[model samples]
Target: MSKPSGKSMDEIVALCRRRGFIFQSSEIYGGINGFWDYGPLGTELKRNLKNAWWEDVVLREMVGPDGKTIEMVGLDSTIIMHPKVWEASGHVAGFNDPMVGCKTEGCKRLFRADKVFMVDLGLDPSGKHVDVGVEADSKAKAEELAIGIAKRFKIRHDANPNPIAFSVLEEFAEIPTDMQRFPCPNCQHRTLTPPRPFNLMFESHSGPIQSDDNKVYLRPETAQGIFVNFLNVVNTTRVGVPFGIAQQGKAFRNEVTPRNFTFRSREFEQMEIEFFIHPSTAKEWYAFWRDNRFAWWQSVGLTSANLQLREHEKDELAHYAKEGAGTSDIEYRFPFTAPGFGELEGVAHRSDYDLRQHAEHSGLRDKMKYFDQERNEKYFPHVIEPSAGADRGTLALICEAYTPDPSRPSGVYMKFHPRMAPVKAAVFPLVNKEGMPEVAEKLYRELRKKWVVDYDPKQSIGKRYARMDEAGTPYCLTIDGQTLKDNTVTVRYRDTLQQERIGIDRVGEFLGQKIGSAQV
Candidate 1:
């Protein structure tokens, strides 16, 4: 309302902080970069999203096309594991970003050269920078010319005669030596050294004194924890292949540059499910999850025109992935892309990569064996992972639901689906007098049994209605003099702003149908 002060992304972040949805981590000490803490409303909203995910992929897998349903079990995994786990997973060796630090005056900014170049030129780093043209054209010449300009002007790692752990992009391009930096790229005041790799994992000691054997790492992804414990669940629960292990947990990533608010964070929560299927069935399930995740966004009321599926290029797959896909592929159809089309979720086909790595390093990997006596098949199960960021989804939901009332320019409210709204309904007393307060209190207490309801008696009935509307409470109930005599109350709808008098006893039933029927 009031045209909302900052830009969309800025407004969302400000609203979140003001409403106690989230806060910067360690704010008292100037805050830690790339980490955040969820306050009251933020916690509730996050839990709502997690609850929604659990209800679908975990508690109920939903009905299949054949009209049959599947029940899936859930897993709560550890936040840290053995250090060797990272080594075998290829994280210790390959989990890195090519960084070049600048000592330009007081500006000691370390950056991903690849990203900064595109950012400076106002281009999508994920697009043409990595693509070669379809055929011989001026595009190739332009790209080559652009590369030459970038190497000389752009801040990058210095040149070297010996091999560096990770080579700079221009080095492999056979650019002229004059373009390479012999001294620090930022200052050009000191002789430069070759670029080196930096491990991204956060390490910790098991006991008092740190030692080699006691070394452990904070998990970079939730999927690995599930994969490491797959055998335990399979053997103990006696669940065969084709089952999944769903987990919601915290993960840490030491990013080189964490910008665009919480879009890229050092610490965040993730909702991941490793659906195990036969290797032959992995592709089929991958497609199935791609659609399922897409539908999930829609169910939360996201416009389909705002989302699309994109298959990864052959060179883009990770060492463990055979087939990988992203959820936000199409360009911005929806207004909020301040940081540009943020990835809401992804599904990747990881073919026994995790289990095989753990088995090779830890000597504990057992190939998942499934027997179909009639079909006579047994093999290690391939996995399709539907990984999503809880924060990203939470933020996207806010953006999607945020609406400015055209009729009432000063009024703003979230049009959240009932299942996702933090407060489903608000109960108010028409006046804080006579027996109205007591009657409204009774209704509020009763309604809380079935929904998340708030009681507001500090302001006028009109003021209370506006407050609830701003909080995205879909339904509001007010007890008036009529309620004391006839046991009837006014039920106000948030979206339509229509009020209907209903028997007090039937308010619970009436609201339940409306709230429950709303999509997630």
Candidate 2:
């Protein structure tokens, strides 16, 4: 299962476009910057990951020794909520990226220096390598130097001879500057600006009236929705303090710079859980959630070697959390892709900050309550939030599944686990004629109900299998002359290329057992 070497970030992006995994959004009009559209194969893979996450965290009903499973529930909420909510959540004033603008001659482009470095290195700008605290007093000088280097490397444009090189305009264009600005972490120049807040939330008008009172924001994270709706569900269901409300939904952030394909898009899906616990037990529950989430990722086929656990230092802890722990470093395969561990998931023990915020802002203090068996023990329940980026999870699965079988000439085959593969089993006809197509089509229809199946009769059997392999189909079923003779078909495994003759009538049962409720 060796990975393909010497592949650059551009090469992977081109391959994704060629193989129908992803496409630049609105390409006809030169495409929108920082946006992407998932193609058939990519969409399937993303969907499978989402479904798998729901099954693992939401519906599992996992129980611990403390009998806390009874308090968990799943919830869905709106993307936009009351404008005051963001204000109370600290997003209105504190959510922001430190952006440094290049005030150079004929070039004022705001360079997310962090992103610029990543782009140069073919890396993901996931806050691993770029530092934004650099004092850019010589902004003009830095822009000149950077533009000259970009030209020398000829890295500004796609390799289409369109000369998309970095150009200067009298008016500086605003680019995302989300990197850490050290007086110069890279050069150690020691001139640093005090960190300031850059709100990432997208604000909008809630009603036709464009007034200050109507200002609302698209949620920056899905966890807030669950938090806001906490009392409603708890009071209605009469659930206890240890219960949780899990959610999977879209959140919008005005990311200073959206790069690394869809990894840090302005809009993305999040799988989050707000586990309520006694204030006294918040730290323990935080640790518990952290371990559980880390284990879940490993169970889903992300190799343990490629992941790490990073604990947030005291100073780095968020304003609300008493403590927090992060997942270990993730090694992705893009250039400039940072080598350090970033937080893939985090479990933060927030001591009722959210509940207090909502209560004070909305004057609903009495509505939210918790009564424990400690008779007189009564207070707002603390929360341990386990949150992860859905896109990152999918990318990790792809990275883990990415394999190049030495036996195959095509170089690489994504060896996705049975549950994660986009297509579980590709149904193909041995040939385009002799009623084989009819049989394959019938089989495809039947299997499509139970699996994400594909039927391809245009290519030879070997070629078809290769195509499926690239798409990460776990198995391929072929209908040949032997099938008409014995009511049997060849079930070929993608990774091993081993074929087995199995009765056609029993195909579903065989696959169900083989894939049986695996975590993937």
Candidate 3:
């Protein structure tokens, strides 16, 4: 029989749950939206991804255009910094998503209007698709498009006996504000409230006071925490200018609509690096970091064919980078949207804006610069930040690795890179008896000392192999009747399904060589 190809997002989600990779946050009591918990396999897959990013991208040394190599240091900053941190970073005023809700009595669902409209109009909402080139002009044309789309479209309404025709949807495309202006997407009634700035930061009261006196917000991005600690890292580590501070941690945003599984979530983790460089050197550094970041994503098993380098238009640039810096996004070909792609990471050139803002707001304005020891002059360092979401990265890896199970056309498997597989190796016995179980168990125990190995003596060898493939186990070692006569086991490869005989004593070394390392 012929093998299958790729899988759908819905299929991936189902497989994740079935294989103990991910689960909804509180299944018993009606689970929360925009939040999910990583199960055992999901956790390993995520951990390996984060470690790979850190090892290959963040912590590595890089040479600048001037041929000077710079080293990067890692930081684990607080999830909640000083309340003024938000004000300094512009998160308080700028970190907002436009939200519109249905005015229907019971189906009052809120959604990110731009995203929904793109989907409704058969447009892909990725940074590389709906948000680039012509998308640069979309800010001025969204209302026009919504108007055009509505002229011929009719949708059901809560009050009207029939669907509303040519309903007004201006509110959905209008600029961000605190007004209700569009029709409810659910009920065709012109019941959508005005577009409002929904600040995404999760807020809380610090200390004993529960008032504005101690108001603070959970860190919405990991970069700010790294920005504020520039002085500490430079001083303690003896790091010089043009260096970077990397961080990976949890961030919070009360998303209006957190659809697409873990791709967008209210509580998520971020892996970010704020690379400091001279203002005159920002362009070179930007290109360098951008290319390196792009390559790293591909190295993590995302196919190059499906990745895109989406440069930000002048209009798409963030407020801090618009004046003097460049910005772009690395988008991936996801399966959910029509275009099958979306933004996975953002690479931006943020001039001294961040450090400048932090200094002025935190009473450290003069303290955020670096001294050129050779020139004996001090200047505020511009930054080229490559920021990525951990959840999205994990999802992208899952998407890239997922394939249909060949044995069962309807079933699926993960063709994860050897280094990226959750369980490194799976051990199985051809049959439950015939001393096969003892050999498989012995090999499994020995391999577990060096790798995350799975042991199974139940079911037929074919079924066990199918389960291992689904879980993305790169190698499957089967101890069969032949193993009783000789100390060799049949090692089946997950990606190719090729089998070869290897001595039981050499299984560890065999896998270590195939996977590049023991994985321990």
Candidate 4:
């Protein structure tokens, strides 16, 4: 079954901007494409998400398929590394996307070749039905093509025999040599250039002199850092084979088209695990990680039908996983891709390719082998990697939490999981007098030491509850008139809008029960 987010991308983006969740980078200067800035709320939400992942994967005690405890360690690698690192990882030579450019005068624009589709506009001229094709890279662009054609032909919007009736002709794997037949999406003219390779890595100079010798590139992934340091980890730690190295850090990629908010940004964060295991047990470990990672996402509040697990096809395998058991993806059905899913995470069986490549390139082939004491043999251990995008996962959580209702003043409330909510609880005074403020402030001070709690006594009780609901605060403790007499407070629940009076001393225990401990 497929679950569609009743919300639209426009609504989600608007909420992000209005509620201080996210903002476009350099927005005052018309903003830069493929970049974004997270606001205070967004930063807290992302930090909580990353912390949850780290605690679950690295700090928590995990069991392997053999019923033994798994060993996992953490690493923080630099964003800029030795230039030779990219050479060994195949990013320097093979990380290229097929690109095509529109040559229309004063309107040049580039697009990924495979993403450009040719659509038949079905324009009839002189009683003969003629197929007029236009190029577009998205559904919005296709709608623009239809409107442009309607205006050019002086056809009314309500006319029968619509001139804009059309369907996709084909997607261009590569623009043909005779590219004049295809029209430009912007200029609506036959001016698209042939396809060519465009590298996605960002380049820079490492020294004072700007020359080829001092040139460097940003690390495109965090996995290579783990692979290059595998020997150091094995030597310094007590972990044997069947161990894993986990990392969470920033990664860079100059995406040609960074659309769908932060989904395809040029800069992002990744939570990746590279598990080293015996070559003979690669299949079992691969299946275990695939299922384990899927369940982890569900445990963190992705319990809707929008989440799914899909196995990769033969052609979909990455360069390193071709000789292994294959790759599986945990995908989410976002608002933009409703009824169709987008990749949230991937669990791949990367057969000793990384270690082998790094060892061969660094001339440490003999030292890179792992000695199995049980089998009394030395060999390169196979890898099972579970890579997840921090930014993408945070966005999915936000998309899943957005709930609209006509009965409330704010019309919508964020239904974030108690463990994942930015503000765990809010304390409000029914009115700003009669010792209620003192009581609420004391409670706020105490709770803030344990979890993120808000204190808002400047507004009406209903308004305060509305604000906290929008912020996804699970519980709200209100010090009402009865608090001073009986020493009890009203606890308002965000999801059901139900309230019940409870002892003032039990507030801490109440929050602890609803949400988890403050450690994560």
For each candidate, the alpha-carbon lDDT, in order, equals: 0.67, 0.68, 0.76, 0.84
Worst 10 contiguous positions by lDDT, candidate 3: 127-136
Local accuracy of candidate 1 as per-residue lDDT tens digits, 276-323: 877766656777778787777777666645565666676667667734
TM-score of 4: 0.83
Worst 10 residues of 2 by lDDT: 162-171
Lowest summed lDDT across 10 adjacent residues in model 4 is found at 162-171
Full-model lDDT, candidate 4: 0.84
Better structure of 3 and 4 per TM-score = 4
**Candidate 4 colliding pairs:** none
Q: Ranking under lDDT, best-scoring first? A: 4, 3, 2, 1
Off-target runs (Cα >4 Å) in candidate 3 are 1-6, 58-64, 95-197, 405-410, 517-520
lDDT of 2: 0.68
Q: Please state every model's RMSD to the true fold in angstroms.
A: 8.2, 11.9, 9.6, 9.5
* Number of the predicted model whose TM-score against the real structure is largest: 4
Model 4 agreement with the true structure over 1-520: per-residue lDDT tens digits: 3345788778889988988888999999999898889997788788888989998899888899989999999988888888888998999876665667888779798866655554444434545433333455564566557656646745334323433323222344443655666656556566778777788898888988899998788888899999999999999999999999999999999887899999999999999999999989999899999999998888888889989999999988987888898799999999988889889999999999989998999999878999989889999999999999999999999899999887999898989889888999999999999899999999999999999899999967888888887788889999999999998999999999999999999999988888873331
Considering lDDT, which of the candidate structures 3 and 4 is the better prediction for this target?
4
